[model samples]
Target: MPYTPRKAYVVGVGMTKFDKPRGERDYPELGLEASVKALIDAGLTYDQVETAAVGYCYGDSTCGQRALYQLGMTGIPIVNVNNNCSTGSSAFAFAANAIQSGQAECALALGFEKMAAGSLGSAWDDRAQPMEGTMTQLFEIEGDKEYEVDDFGPFAARIFGAAGQEYCEKYGATWDHIAAISAKNHKHSVKNPYAQFRISPSSADVAKARKITREVTLPMCSPTSDGGAAAIVCSEEFVKAHKLEDRAIELAGLGIATDSVKLYEDKSRIELAGADMSRRAAQKAYQQAGITAKDVQVIELHDCFAPNELVTYPALGLCAEGEAHKIVENGDNTYGGKWVVNPSGGLESKGHPLGATGIGMIAYMALQLRNEAGDLQVKDVKHALTHNIGLGGSCVVTVLKKAPFYKEGSHCKDRFGYDFAREERRMTQEELDKVRSKHFSDYLPPSVPESKL
Candidate 1:
C-alpha cells in the first residue's frame, strides 16, 4: 500500500512587529510575544505543546532554548534549524511533520532573528563559505565583464540584480517593470501594521531611489529586520478535542526543495538564485494539494528583492515562463487581477527577519483564510499559498485552505462574532495575564481605555 500522510492544521498563529535590527526588544522578548499570541489564538497553553522547532540564522548554539525559556521550560524536545532565509518555514515544516507523524498532538514552530545593523555577511572567514558554489557560477557567467561590486549593499543584491538584467536581455523586461514590482509591494505594506516599512512609494520614486546594485534600488531589497513569528500545529484529533474547527486552517500541502544540478550547470542566473528550487517545491505542493495556481486566491512569496519576485512568478506557475513581466504590466499579480501576490507586503516591505519570514507568511495566509486580515484582507479567499527561499539553498512552498469541518455556528463565531481582528485584541490581555501569572507573578497588564476595547 502507498504511504498516506496524516493531516495537520494550523490552529494558532502570531508575530511581533518587524523592526530594524537593534531597534527594540531582544530575541527572547520577540519570541515570547509571538508564541504567547499563537497559544492564545489556539485556545492552548504552553504545557500542551509536545514538541517544538525553532529557527534562526545568526545566533549561538541552543538559542532556541534561551528564547523559548521565556514561555516556560516544559522540557519538550526542541529542534534548532538554520536554513538561511528559509529557516522559519523549515521550522514550521518540522513542526507539521511532528503532528502528521503522530509524534505530537500539538507542536510549535517559532522563528526569530536579531541581526546586525548592516548588510548580511559571513560570521566566519576561517573556512569555505557555503555560497562558494553559487558565487563561482556567478563569476563564470560574468566572465570578461567588469562589474563593480557594491561595498555597502548585500551580495544577494548583485545575484538577483543580474538575474533581472538577464530577464530583460532574454525577454523584454525593463527597469521600469522591476520598479513597478517594488512599488506594488511597498503600497501593499501601507495597510500592514506589523510591517517594518509602511511607506508606499510610486514606481517612479522606486526607480529613482538610491541604487543598491545593477538596476536594483534601495526599495527593491528587503531590509535586515529583528522580529519573530510562530504557528501552532496540531493533528485533526487535537483540533476536534479542543473544539477548534472554526479557527483551524488546514495545512493542505507543503513542499521543500534544494538546489539541483541546474544551479551550477545552467547559464541562467535566475536558476542559480533558487528559481528551480522554488519551481520544484511549488510543483510538489500543488500536486499534494491537488490544486493549480488558478485555484489560489492569495499568495505571500519571498520577495527578498523585487527582481526575485518577478522571476518567481513563472516558477510558482503563476504565469508562463518569459511572461512574468507581462503579468506585472497587466496588473495580474495584484488585487482585482489574477492573484493578490504578497498581500502582507511580502519580504520586501513587511521586512525579512530571516527565520521569522517563513512563519510570518504562514501567519498572514492563515489570517487571510480566516477572513481576519483586516485592511489587508483579499476578497473571497479560498486557498492561499506561501513561498519562502534560502539561498545556498532551499525553498519551501505550502498550500493552506479553510478547514472543511468548520461551521458557521462555531466557538469563534459564538464568542467573537468571527471578527478575528477584534478577537485578537480582546484576548491579548487575558492571555498575557494567564501566561505571566504562571511564570512571572508580578506582571501587570497594560491599561487600555474602555473606548478602545
Candidate 2:
C-alpha cells in the first residue's frame, strides 16, 4: 500500500507589519509578537505546541530558541531553518510534516528577520559561497553582456534581469509588461495594511523608477525588510479536540523542490532563475491536492522581482509558456480575471523579510480563505495557492482550502468578535493589559500615564 500522509490544518496565522530594515523591533520582539498573535488567534496557549520550526537567515545559530523563549521555555524541540528566502515556508513544511507523521499533534512554524539597510549580500566573505554554482551558471549565460557582476544593484537583480531579457527575447514580452506587474502588485498593496508599500504607483511610474539593471527597475524589486510571521499547525485529531473546525484551513497539499539539473545544465536564463524548480514543486503540489491551476482562485507568489513573477506564471501553470505577458496585458492576473495573483501585494510591495515571507504568504492565504482579508479579499475563493522561493535555492508551493466542516462567519464572529469582511483593528491597550495581567503577570506593566492606569 502507498503511504498516506496524515491530514494537517492551519488553525491560526498571524504576522507583523512588514517594515523597512532597522525598524524599532529586533528579531526576538518581532517573532514573539507574531507568535503571540497566532496563539491568540487559535485560542490556545503556547504550552499546547508540541514542537516548533523557526526560520531565519541573518542570525546566530539557535536564534530560534532565543526568539521562542519569549513564549516561555517549555522544553519543546525547536528546529532552526535557513534556506535563504524560502526559509519560512521550508520551516512550515517541516512543522506540517511533524503533524502528518504523527510526531507531534500541534506545532508552531515561525519566521522572522532583522536585516540591515540596502540590498541583500553575502554575510561571510572568506568562505566557499553557496551560490558559487549559480554564479558560474549566470556568467556562462551572460558571457558577453557587458554586465559587471558586482556593479549590478544586487546579484538577484542581475539573475532575474537576465531572465527577464531572455523571456522577452524568446516570448516577445516587453519591458512594459514587467513594469505592469510591479504596478499591479503595488496597486494591490494599497489595500493591505500589513504591506510595506501601501501607496500604489502607476505603470509609467514604475517603469520610470531608478533602474536596478538594464531590464529591472527599482520598484520592480522587493525591498529588504524586517518582520515576522507565524502559523499554528495541528493534526486533524488535534483540531477536533479543540473544536477548531470552523477556523481551520486545511493544508490540502504541500510540495518542496530544490535546484534541479537544469539550473546548471541549461543555458536558458529562465531555468537559471529557478523557474524549473518552481514548476516541479507546483506540479507536485497540484498533484497531491488532486487539483490543478484551474481550481485555484487566488495566489500569493514570490514576486521578489517583477520579472520572476512573469516567469513563474508559466512555471505554476497559470499560463502557457511565453504568454505570461498576455495575462498581464489582458488584466487576467488580478481581480475580475482568471486569478487574483499576489493579492497580498506580494513581496514586490508587501516586503520580503526573507524568513518571514513564506509564512507571511501563508498568513495572507489563511485570511483570504477565511474571508478575513478585508479590503484585499478575493470573491468566491475556493482554493488558494502559495509559491515561495529562495535563490541558492529552494521553493515551496502549498495548497489551502476551507476545512470541510467550516461554516461561513462562524469562527471570526464567535471567537474574535469581528466581521470577517471588514478590516481587523489592533487590540486596544485595555485588552492587551487584560491579557498581560491574566496570563503574563511576570511581564512588566505597560508604561502609561498614572491617570490612564
Candidate 3:
C-alpha cells in the first residue's frame, strides 16, 4: 500500500539584502523588518499568524520577544530556536511540522542575524574565554600543552582537505576545479541584488589571490553580513480558504541528523553525520514527493566552505561517493546543468548570515519555482531541495515541489539514473565557455596568468 502524503505549504517569503554594513542594526530591528515583509508577502495580517518560531544563533536575551514587541503585542506563543548554522532551517522545519501536526493552521518562521556579532569563531566559540581560562585551555592535554588551532578549524580542515584530495585522486579533479566552483558562485552572485559579495572572479584569479589567512581569501570566502529572512507557512485548508493555492509551495520532506564533533572519533564514518541525515531526509522527501533526485531541477547546499559542497554532493547522491569535484570541473553545477546548484550564489559568495541562511535558501528556491528568480531561474523547476549543515555537521534537508504534484500522485523518474560517469562524460567545452564569459578580471591575483586554463 502507498503512503498518504503530509501536506504543508509555504505561502509567503521575504528577505533583506545582505550588506557589509558600517553599523549593525539590532536583532529586533532586523527581525521586525523581515517579519513585516513576510506578512506583506503572504497577504496576511499579524493576527493570522498562530505562532512565531524565530531563529537566531547570536542575539541578546529576549531577542525574539523584543522583536515581536515592535509589532503590536500578540498573545500568541513565540518559540525561539537556536541550532548554530542550521538554525534557520530548523525553525522552518518546526513551523511546517506544527502545521502538519494540526497544532496550528498558520505559523511564521523568521531567521535573522547581524554582523555586530562578528564571524562564526568569535560569535559561537568565544575566543576570549580560552584567554581568560573560564573555558578549558585551548588544547591542554590533562595539564600539558595547548593545541594551536583547537577543535573547529583543524577538524574541519582535516576532513575537507582529506576528502578533497581523495576526490581529486579518484576523479582527476584539480585544485583549479575546486576553485572553479567558488568562481561559479561568485559569478552568479554578481547578479543577485541581495548578495553581500556581488562580484565575480575567474578561477585563475581565485587560485592566485593573496591569502587573507591560510588558503582563505577575501574573494574565496563570504563576508560577515547583517540580514534577515522570513517565511509564512500554513495548512492546506487555510491556503484553500484564503485562495492561496497559487502561492503555496508544498513541503515534501524534512530530515535532521548529527555527527561526532571530534574528527577522529569515528574513522569508519567517511560521510559526516549530517550527510547520513541528509541522505535519509532525501529518501523520505523522494517518497513523499513521488520523485527521484533527477526530478529536482535546482538545489542549494550548505556551502559555508567550498569543501562542504564537495562532501555534500555525494551524500545527496548528486554524484558518486567521492566524485563531487568532477561535477565542478565539468560545469554541471552551473547555470544549465542537469540540476543547478546554488543559483543564489550559495554561502561562498551570497553570504552566510548564520541564522538567516536556511530561510534564505528556501526563499530563493521558492522564487525559482515561481519563475521570479530573474537571471538565476532554472528552466522548469518542478521540484527543488535545500540542504543546510550546521556546526559539528548537524544537517537539515527540506524538499519542495511545485503545484499539481499532489493530485496526480505521479512518481518522477531519474532521466540520467545513478550514473555518475555518464554525467561526467557529458561535460563539454561549451559548458565551460558560459562560465568564462561571466568572469570579472579585476578579482584575479596579480601573479596568475589569465589565458591558461
lDDT of 2 by residue, 320-406 (tens): 999999999899899999999999898989899999999999998998898878889999989999999988889999999998877
Positional deviation of residue 298's Cα in model 1 after best superposition, in angstroms:
0.4
Runs in model 1 deviating more than 4 A are 146-153, 409-430, 435-453
TM-scores of the candidates in the order shown: 0.92, 0.93, 0.79
Query: Which parts of model 2 are misplaced by more than 4 Å?
Result: 146-151, 409-453
State the lDDT of candidate 3 residue by residue for 199-240, as single tens digits. 889988987885443344445555667888889898888987
**Pairs of residues at least 3 apart in sequence or in different chains that clash in candidate 2:** none
On residues 45-159, what C-alpha lDDT tens digit does candidate 1 reach at each position? 7878889999999889888878776566566899999999999999999999998888999999999999988788999989999998887778788774676443335678888
Q: Put the candidates in lDDT order, highest first.
A: 2, 1, 3
lDDT of 2: 0.86
For candidate 1, what is the TM-score? Answer: 0.92
Clashing pairs in 3: 139-147
Error of 2 at 38 (Å): 0.7
CA shift at 381, candidate 1, in angstroms? 0.9
